[model samples]
Target: MKFTFFTALILLFAPLTSYSLSQISNPNYDPELAEKLGADDYGMKSYILVILKTGENTSINKEMRSNAFVGHMKNINKLVDQKKLIVAGPFGKNNNDFRGIFILDVSSIDEANLLLETDPAIKEKYLKAELYPWYGSAALSEYLESSDKIWKVNP
Candidate 1:
């Protein structure tokens, strides 16, 4: 069979393309860690992601805002210590209507909702939690372990 120039080019690159794809799978794959991380065939696991948005009750009083936020951060620290909260951060410079988000390592959205309720910001109605079912890499669970080497935030 005669092949066109483009077809010949594709044939030449096909093996290299497949080789590049297979390289993504590590040679030192860990089966135990894969199972423990809830990784599926795609190496992704379900998570409850909570978006912290400004509630209907906007803060006019600076003291109340500071108090609630302080408590909210303390609540986040508590969850981190428990290893229930995987990732938390603000969406600054992204856009309006979004303050921050929390990616919980909990098993269910109900658990994540209850955990968010402990935040003073959510409890006081200063910040509302919008929970969503999300799927992300199982390796995301390792962030905190290597975070200490990054830098410390002095309060």
Candidate 2:
């Protein structure tokens, strides 16, 4: 009976104790900004990280492949404009089959998969997407404004 009561107390308080320990007062903490960015108490939120890999469809004609990738880039721009994609970039030449990545500002794998379907590269099997849940700073989207200014050439 005593052990059960002690265990209950520990379980009840553990989350509050850990939460308090993890929270450090920040001088620059802005509640309004955090709320606008959909941040949690930690100023972080869930996202779907998609790793694009080379697909098995090697028989596709060069023109079809080119067209698919063109659609892919356009779809990326569209997603960024819609604020659904926070980050998207291709990996440099590497031994791994990874072709690119997209950090999608979505909560569920289902939502990410739906968004990815808009990309012709993934739909046409030119690229395969592997999705994982990611936790990142909610402020990540803020970088896009500056990124648009600095990019002299559109990729």
Candidate 3:
């Protein structure tokens, strides 16, 4: 594990795992926040990550490409607004085949795939996606609800 400062605080304060939640008891806990954060007795959840990569069909026309990307952005915002997508962003300054990623609040890879199929970029073959199961803070799902205060945009 990367022993960062915040990670240290998480391990010390947060219930790093379901088992840890069972072991530790915090007297001062907020019920409303707990429910909002999905911290059922254990603060854990199963999430999915979708990676968007350069697909084979990159020879799209310039005009079509612009529309495709705009449509893709709109689709992403739709997913975020729907709370299916927790986090989504493009990779910058990377020469690798990687393009962008989406952290989806879905249980299974199949569910994530179904959501990704709606992307115009993926439909046009400008970007293809690969999904993998991920586990992280259940509270992360709430980030989308508050992110607008920071980003000031639907993204």
Candidate 4:
């Protein structure tokens, strides 16, 4: 019984110990980068506002839009893995002003732009993405403190 309990405790704490050791050894190990890349994969969320152009709008049929949404959904997992996008969805009825929004977990506005460049809709002129720096509620403000990563408000 004692042996089994000791083994279980070691197993439970082994990862924590390793993480602590890594942090100690690499004093510059960025908490933000770690959070972005670690196994837990927790990342700061920021909204990407998309505006659809009026004149050259690529409004395909409803069926095609549905199919495209499905295809976009399929590629989302890869985006998350790359820490480019976290969550994305179209706005509801009352919020039709913008075309859509993508919540991303990138490190900078430049990174966000790169990610936006990958979208077929944006590439094809169906939409254009403008990133905005988001400061979440009081409980989640730490993630938004990185000046280099945060987007600037447009005048």
Q: lDDT tens digits, residues 29-63, model 3?
A: 77788877666676767789888899878674899
The CA lDDT of each predicted structure is: 0.87, 0.94, 0.83, 0.55
Best by TM-score: 2
Residue ranges of candidate 3 with Cα displaced over 4 Å:
1-22, 152-155
Worst 10 residues of 2 by lDDT: 146-155
CA deviation > 4 Å runs, candidate 1:
1-26
Residue lDDT tens for model 1, 131-150: 99998998897879898577
Leading candidate by lDDT: 2
Quote each prediction's TM-score.
0.77, 0.85, 0.76, 0.45
Candidate numbers sorted by lDDT from highest down? 2, 1, 3, 4
Candidate 3 clash total?
Answer: 0
What lDDT would candidate 1 get against the real structure?
0.87
Give Cα distance to truth, residue 109, candidate 3, Å. 1.1
Rank order by TM-score, top first? 2, 1, 3, 4
